[model samples]
Target chain A: MDEMSAESRYADWIAVHAGQSDLRAWALAADGSVRAELTLPSDSAMPEAPAFEAKLLDTIAPWLGQGSTSVLACGLTGLADLPEAITPVPAKPAERLPIRVSANDPRLDLLALPGLSQANPPDLLLGEETEVAGFLAGNPGFDGVLCLVGPRTVWVQISAEEIVSFQTAMTGEFFDLLAGHSTISAAVASTGMDAEAFVDAVSDTLSRPERLSQRLAALRGQHVLQQLDPSVARSRLFGALIGAELAAMRPYWLGQQVALAGPSDMVDLYARALDTQGVSAPRHASDGLALAGLARAWFAMQEHAK
Target chain B: MDEMSAESRYADWIAVHAGQSDLRAWALAADGSVRAELTLPSDSAMPEAPAFEAKLLDTIAPWLGQGSTSVLACGLTGLADLPEAITPVPAKPAERLPIRVSANDPRLDLLALPGLSQANPPDLLLGEETEVAGFLAGNPGFDGVLCLVGPRTVWVQISAEEIVSFQTAMTGEFFDLLAGHSTISAAVASTGMDAEAFVDAVSDTLSRPERLSQRLAALRGQHVLQQLDPSVARSRLFGALIGAELAAMRPYWLGQQVALAGPSDMVDLYARALDTQGVSAPRHASDGLALAGLARAWFAMQEHAK
Candidate 1:
């Protein structure tokens, strides 16, 4: 980082969020204040030891020194080595003991953070736990359901600082696959989203969720029969999927204090979808929550050592 | 074909069924008995005139004579040039006028036949119309619904040999895309069908058509948490999708004489899914119906000439 020298102990520590798409690392000083941030394309969803170590070094090596600098990396980066990365729920999000990486570098102390898992509905999360912890850090006494919208949208129930249960929907994956590569890609590829169209489609699908496949085919039919606006078509596709999800997940967000977290853009989309249902979703920056969660974990580990 | 020599009027005419994946054509005698059958990969869903003409000639040229041998073609082969191919419903499936293909070969008389369309529900079918015609040709007095399964599965409401209305579902497309490339592909890539798992999943989703997305996600969760058999996982995934479709199309199959048409394997899958709902779906050889419908169109065209 430009803020400090690279000779020795340049960064006191580092916190990283390695996800399916990319890896984000923040170099932190002793006070847990971030000095600089670096991002790189991820190695894989669940990266192996050698490749994960190489990526971590490439991300943090310039900031490393001859002395030990602890690296607290969360997400799928080192998950394969961390057999305990899936912590059973009804406990703190940061309850699992992060596995130490089998490393060749002397100045490295790497810990792979584990995500939370629920047994009832059979659900698991990769990196959202850190963000949840970060949300909890900001709102210590807050108790409500958190909707984290990302590549995989997760509906989490929280009370007394423990993750009670969660439900995940493959809505994002379906959206990506169908919109990018499927036959509906022509209708889904648009530079803009139509708000009115999105609302209408959401209502339609919410009222009749079972007709989702038929509605998907209708997108193509309407595109062919009528000159359906690309923006409107895209919005309608998203709306149908989100609407159906909301109907299925009514028990999760029907009458609860709800907050939305993720990248602001996607978070806003979910916010708008929930708005149609007359549910107000407060927004939280996913990256900020992630950093906060990582810091909280680091702070707690420090406390445990003390 | 080897059954007939390449000479003048060795075969009276040809009936073709061109679809999204492939094209099937039959050289027939004047009485409509199939002299020989041929199948080739389709040019495209809606191919250009040049490619369609080339493929048609390539398929039928060997059997053509010095005389203008009439070729009656149907499906997506020549659909692009036939804007009027979408024959409006409340009419016979073979009611649309066939468009003549502009050709350089003097001995080939190729005509592109169109399929039936419905406006209310916004549906389209490329080649399924011929199969419906064949079904009607055999059962002129029958009145009920037809489920045509393929790249896109269509449910047609037939009344007294005339098309009433139809619904198109992207179940096949969705199933193909998800099982091939999605994150849960590992769970879906199986070689066998688990009947019990499929039936159970069908009932589960039939009772809860709204929870389709969650059930999809649970496939992955269960695969990871438990020793989920690949075949069972694949069956569960299919059952969920088809179950949801059946729940939506309950009105189409409930208390109706339903016939399933398509490739035998896919038709059997739909047949099984419908059987769970206490509906008996008679299987129809899709190719036979397509050829029969084409021959019927040829016969009617000749009668018009007379």
Candidate 2:
């Protein structure tokens, strides 16, 4: 089974999200179990169309079998108005479709899926849409806000399997800048998450959003004034940024059914933040969602194939 | 004169704000005219007492005469509760004194000024305090909000010649990061300012402060969606950040007599922001304000000398 023999190609589907710096793919066995996963840095070259396709194939070559299998992909950035793709928001979930991209790999029938986009506010999500779709597929009739805390956090309003509206915050990028790229890096520890400090900081900023900048400086101030613990500093910074985000995103999570889908620790933070608002959210692990979303897309394409 | 002469050193006072990256000083003649100005990078070495003084004298060597002079200085970071420094807040302006630093450079009698500190908020202003003092000295009996828009913007409320309260915003550093250092940098022109777009952006963020992060991402979205002009992108980003800042700082400028002190262009932007709120702010050129502030301290020191 470990060998890449012809019989090994029994996997039914694969899903790939070609991000700017990294490429991640999931392979689903015939029984819909995630059979294999692959991750590789995509920074070897810019994603010129053919090169990107070839790179995707090279990264997942081990999982490929001589048997033709359907593959679905989504890039890190969204593509709009693709003829084959579904307009998730403007249409009913049951009638929606995923964008289909032509991939010229011999062993795979590859179709690239479209990410979500909003026309009026001009919002876009490339890869996370599939994850959301997968989450919806698993939890049918899930209606409420889904918060995905990733490199960019997206808060989407989902009702009856449809994405109503969504907003993205630069939470992760902001965190990266504060912890490693900005002036405050010297004063904060990039590691460790202090639950208590994170909660308090979140609460502090939520009440006084006007003091966001001052409080940011106070991270350094406390570092100087009281020898602030590095873990505490990290927590404070996270809390402040997230607090500001929550303030902006209050309408989405306030007194609503909230579900969080992202990495475990990030989901934990978001869960805790919402908890303070007297809102309880169910936490879901986001592993298999991408493949599930791709499987959905593949199933849709089969309808097209017929 | 091309030559450094003894008579040239006859200036009665020197004022310096030793910053993290640069040192700026002003030489005050006996009659209070700015005799000369000097600036140099402060990063040649750490600001140890001897080296800092030596570096200070060396940079202002051409302006120094043989005459004994009192030097007043402010470091870039606050030193709270220093015995040698006077606590100005809650003290009458007439009774305030500079924090005297013992300098090895015998060419001048140097007294380092103490920056302002806020205990409740854990805020500090190292160099801007002197500038505020200078602006107050120049515009005596003026009581309202004074905004010094520099590397760090400070809004101070003044009444009866005493510093009432102030708030600091990392506007400048935040702008630098967003335009030149962050992921959005590529989408924005790091140089030009688009006045119209700026004003519009400021208004947008002001109304929806919670959408700041979402709007930041929208800068990039606009780039892809509409091919947003780099200059316009820059303007919009600036406007959004400042707008969010203004939203937080509404109490300072709303229906208050506002005064701005900083570089001309920065003051212009800030003035325009206040103007939108029906607050007309007189812009004061920040040049020589530090020296004037140090001069104020020098006069106070003379009273102590008596």
Instruction: Give the Cα lDDT of each candidate.
Output: 0.79, 0.72
Task: Candidate 1: list runs displaced more than 4 Å.
Answer: A1-5, A8-12, A41-69, A78-85, A94-96, A104-108, B1-15, B25-45, B48-71, B78-84, B103-109
DockQ of each: 0.50, 0.31
Docking class for candidate 2: acceptable
| Model 1 TM-score on a 0 to 1 scale | 0.90
Deviation in Å, model 1, residue B125 alpha carbon: 1.5
- Top TM-score: which candidate number? 1
Worst 10 residues of 2 chain A by lDDT: A77-86
- Please provide, for model 2 over A1-306, each residue's C-alpha lDDT reduced to its tens digit, 9 standing for 90 to 100: 465456555566777876534678887775556767787775311245566667767777767767766666775522322322424454333334655556676786766666566766766666667777788888989889989777678898888777888887877777776676554676686588789999999998888776677778676556644567889999998898889889888889988899998889888998998888898999999766766776777676668769
Model 1 agreement with the true structure over B1-306: per-residue lDDT tens digits: 554544433668888788767888787788888777789885334667677778788887776766788788877765432435566677787555566765667887878776666677766677777778878888787789999887778899889777888888777778887888776786677878889998888888988899998999887667766658989998898889889888878889989989888888778878988898899999987767877778778888877878
